[model samples]
Target chain A: MTETVEGLSINLATVRQQWGFAEAVEGCLRHGIHAIAPWRDQIAAIGLDQAARIVREEGLQVTGLCRGGFFPASDAAGRRAAIDDNRRAVEEAAALRADCLVLVVGGLPAGSRDIAGARAMVVEGIAAVLPDAVAAGVPLAIEPLHPMYAADRACVNTLSQALDICDALDPPQTGALGVALDVYHCWWDPELEAQALRAGPKRLMAHHICDWLVPTRDMLTDRGMMGDGVIDLPAIRRMVEAGGFSGPQEVEIFSAEHWWKKPGDEVLATCVERFRTVC
Target chain B: MTETVEGLSINLATVRQQWGFAEAVEGCLRHGIHAIAPWRDQIAAIGLDQAARIVREEGLQVTGLCRGGFFPASDAAGRRAAIDDNRRAVEEAAALRADCLVLVVGGLPAGSRDIAGARAMVVEGIAAVLPDAVAAGVPLAIEPLHPMYAADRACVNTLSQALDICDALDPPQTGALGVALDVYHCWWDPELEAQALRAGPKRLMAHHICDWLVPTRDMLTDRGMMGDGVIDLPAIRRMVEAGGFSGPQEVEIFSAEHWWKKPGDEVLATCVERFRTVC
Candidate 1:
């Protein structure tokens, strides 16, 4: 449980290019990884029933469904539509029996600079969809992205900010609303340890790991694999564990130029090796 | 004073490619800009004595000396060497009679993964030079770079973290240490307004203005002109004002592809125009 790869989970984005939903599962299974976090596209590729069947048949643990938050919009109608889409995503996460639906709560609307407004919309959208998520028995995991993604990808860009939202929406420290703490997005933060401690075990829903490359080529897809970059993985892993979240350290690299270019087996093999040694 | 260009200052890096020290000073003067911040290289190019003479003769108000901190280093000798260089930079800043010596406190050292250790080095390095800075009567302005630069640029990535250092080093609010708050580096922060309030008048040494472009091209360079990007300039200016600092809002853009390509006069003209209108 403490910086051990025994609980390693692959957030399928790590080897997304080399394998589809079923194929990726096989790859994880081959590497003795029983836990995975798959994106919506992967679920859609193979029908929802088939994806669910695979989960049941293989007895694999779906750590999280990636993801379900783009709440901000230009207007009320658009906002309503986003909430509806989020509800469907919650349903899908439920079908997949995902532990939580990770929310990459979106950034500013197109041609808009009102980040506060966007953030409010994110809160409202999440609140609007909270009922559906609760009814479906699917916990919501707010995944605060890297601040670089603050403009276009996600408004929630810190563990503190995500935990604030969770506190507002589900103040009881219920497992209903929590945070997916990704070291790649948060290792630079000075307040990270304090925020992780504040989140504790109950609100600490998922633990994602990836390295932040020094000369990060592309903002969205240039994530480094474990031990490949500058993140103090063991340090963050220790912090997460101390926070009392004994969840799997989900490897979620989005390295389009590097890891994605490798074969699925090679990627999984490397992940396993790194999981044992570095992470 | 209220988001007006009447107190506008331009950092020379905005048009570094277009002009040398003397030429840039002449260009700024021609645009009715009486204030500027020049980098060390620019000062070194034209002898420091000549540069200081030019500054005095033109009656130019230097808002800040363009940077004096890259403190983190691999070993004791390396760190000691950095502290010595910073002492020299403090001397230069005092020679220029600048308001503050802006410190872009360094990131992780070469082949190092200890961000906490790097941060400790930053603190120790700053503490090492604090007495010299005080003697020189040059306040050390900690310019917390954007988080994206945390690995290779600067570890101090938040106003709060910088302020903590300030509190630790200069607890009496002696104005010996403070922050150069840049909109481009900090616009995405949710705690910006609150932290600005915390900085108040004494610790807010310099106000830097630039825009955060939607697709920030290069992490180091692709900065936008004030009106060209998505920052809420007026709102931040107001927050800074409310925090008790009514200093000149310095224009500092690092647009390698766009603004840097323009003529010095043209860049100065546009900065003047944008300063009056948008910033």
Candidate 2:
């Protein structure tokens, strides 16, 4: 049973408002959660070297880096800038010895209606940064956000679409490029099961667990805890495991009105409880 | 130019609060827009008979009826009740001589986690109502709402998924069943163009036009006017046209903060101008 709890990981954004990177690690450790995923902003706050040092000193298992994508832009210069930024993210993930660098590949560029063009840039951006990721021995996990984010946050909005990109870039089922399946984003997809099967072990890199609130008050920040919302966490987790991923199930809730207001220790404890019984 | 205007239609919900059924039709006529789609509430407010008389008297084209779906329920009685209401809606659509009866099929029933079960109910509900729709000579246009509404508004959230339902119920390409292709709902779908082609002339029943705002303020009512958002109106129209749907490009904007507060005539005028210039 403790081994099952050991497989649980906390995404720092779940307690981001309450604690910085180092404090969040301490909080997770107190709750007996040794695995974590941190957002780039959180790492930047403590400085990458300090964050990496803390991870090494604590012997923490870095599940995945929060993000490294947003590739779309209105012009060639902006696209190049995104690619360069992604390369830096690859180096940072490698420095942390993280399992994978997750990508929330961007949506339509500002004042641009070209979703297809944005998607094209996402492919180009990932391809451009693939060499850096390969050199650093860091995997890239394309996190397909829910369809609601299609317009402004991510054009890659399905497991199938993410797999299509992987097939295009790393066709031989290489562990170099893969997907970070977030249940909150994909629980509603009718094709989820089939696509999960298609993703199979090598391509399915990270498994994120969160719930979809019934009356989702806010589009971005109103994510529910594992058992609180409508997602069948065990069911999705079963599919994920069947597809060959045995990594820690990272909890990544972004509830602005409720959970974020709680104390960091309480939040970590609740995550641990939910991870055991519900997840 | 008048011929193009003849192909333009207004969904009365765009100015629903400002005008009743008759007034909205009169407003559409004054704007040189001969076609209009009315919701059930608007139709019932002024009495459907009177609304039908106005449509008949003015020779106004009833492009499509607003809705007729919400089939899932916790109990058998509730499911049966929904089917009965849908039958009544078919009768209403028949009375108005609308080209098709649009179905914004309901989402998950209360406290239900089984989206697949909810989807099965939708298919069964549509099948139950198919005979009445066929009898009334009203085609059932399954409008696949955007995936954001998958939880509460409509489970059928993709053109392909809707077409799959249509295929199951009316396999012969019988005009009795088809899809109401709404750009606002499907513009983000990467497979949209291909699926529109799949819907082709026979099954492409209706084409709905609206823009997706860059920063959509609300999930239900923050829709932009035709050219005000990021949707490539001309591009989607071209796909719909190529798919063999020569129906009016119905402008359905649920802009609570913007257009709905305006006068009905002003809303209709803007619809005309945007329809001409952008759509």
Candidate 3:
């Protein structure tokens, strides 16, 4: 493990299988990794108060909360429920003093096939929660998932697409909206460097890093650790820097087979090592 | 079957496992399928002469050849080999009088991280072979694979990207260069409709259709049949048709688990049924 890991954050989901919120906080703290992001389920699993106490007591920087966006639905009631849930997520981000609420804008709803409609729902959903997020002082970061996930995970599948929403919802480069650029989700984008540069500082809220495996066995998990796969991390980092984003490069991996099965401390240690050398 | 599909073409890949080239052709013929797009490997297996003779004897409109590009390489020598191979593919396409020789432009070369560089090689490779293809009266249809294949199978992963290559190689709107727009590869693209509009008439060489399974078990082999997954096929077909591509919607399923295991006759029957009803 690296002796120092400044400017790097460990998103708890990277080692989610081995550790819960509190345990992950302790594990990262043991590895000199303070900044972290937790999913709502993780927070809920440990109770918000305890999770907050860990953050407060350890003086860990909450890079961003894992999520709060599944905007598309089949009907008005479903939309209302999504918005209400987003509001709760906004409150959670506020409570945790998170850098932003990372929004995995959802894909087409069940029994529906209109991607444009799902995208419209995402825009409306983000707009519905913008004021609350602004009031809570928690920025919203729309994480454009990879196109493979477009049908089920997120319809907004490109950085340019996310920026379009950011533009539509918050026109003046308002601080309340931005993007969480995850390399695993978007490393293959030809316009990635350009889009990241277009994001600029105000809109580039978070940067996530993980390698894309060549034979990605599973669509959702099976993410490779840094340096173990094909992504040119430093090149993307150069693009991010050129784009004017100089924030924590959070290590957010979902390796259901490899890292998830390792010991939490070992996983944290490897993340530290990879972030220092590869990411 | 709803009995409305007279123009649907069954790409032999949809039922690759159930039959060899001749068998698939016979099966398609039995079901009144007058069109097919056989993979180069399958054609080679039956001997190109036999395949071409069958096409001539039966008078089939081979909508498009299955493939002819994997241009990226670590060195110039390898690239030259790719060009030479493409020339051979062009000849085969000519032999079969296929509408176009589809190009799945290559991804990064082995141990290489520069996708942009790899893409440059693809463009250059295409430029080198464009003359031969044009001379043979075989249109070169650049078929962009999904982004998941960007690292290994294809770096050209969007219709816009493919169209960009076509425009660069054939700026005069020449009929020799065009795109084989596959809904499975490009359905997630936000600029899909606009790109289709951009690729009007002569530039739109072919249209490939297959559903993106909700859980695509294998990234390369688990493609679903039309109407079986999340893609809105009729909508994309509408856009392509509006763009002046009156080509048959070619079925190109690669489902190792499902379709590949089905009887070729049943699969062709299913394709005809889906073509009339769902597609």
* TM-score of structure candidate 3: 0.98
Categorize the docking of model 2.
Answer: medium
How do the residues A1-279 of candidate 1 rate in per-residue lDDT, one tens digit apiece? 223236989999898899999999988888889999999999999999999999999898899999899999899998999999999999999999999999999988998989999999999999999988999999999999888889999989999999999999999987899999999899999989999999999889999998989799988889998999999899999999899998799999998888899999999899899988998
Per-model interface RMSD values are 0.9, 1.0, 0.8
Comparison by DockQ, 1 against 2, better one: 1
After TM-score superposition, what is the CA distance of residue A144 in candidate 2 from its true location, in Å?
A: 0.8
Give the chain A TM-score for each candidate: 0.97, 0.98, 0.98
**What DockQ does predicted model 2 obtain?**
0.74
Give candidate 1 regions above 4 Å deviation. A1-5, B1-5
Task: Name the lDDT of candidate 1.
Answer: 0.92
Quote the positional error of residue B35 for candidate 1 in Å: 0.5
Rank by DockQ (best first) = 3, 1, 2
Q: Per model, how much of the real contact set is kept?
A: 0.67, 0.60, 0.70
Question: Model 3, which residues run further than 4 Å from truth?
Answer: A1-4, B1-5
| Per-residue C-alpha lDDT of model 1 across residues B1-279, encoded as one tens digit per residue | 123246999999998999999999888877888899999999999999999999999898999997888889889999999999999999999999999999999899999999999999999999999999999999999999989999998999999999999999999999899999999888999999999999989999999998988898788889999888889899889989998998899999998999899888888888888888886
TM-score, predicted candidate 1 vs. hidden true structure: 0.97
User: What is the model-wide C-alpha lDDT for candidate 3?
Assistant: 0.91
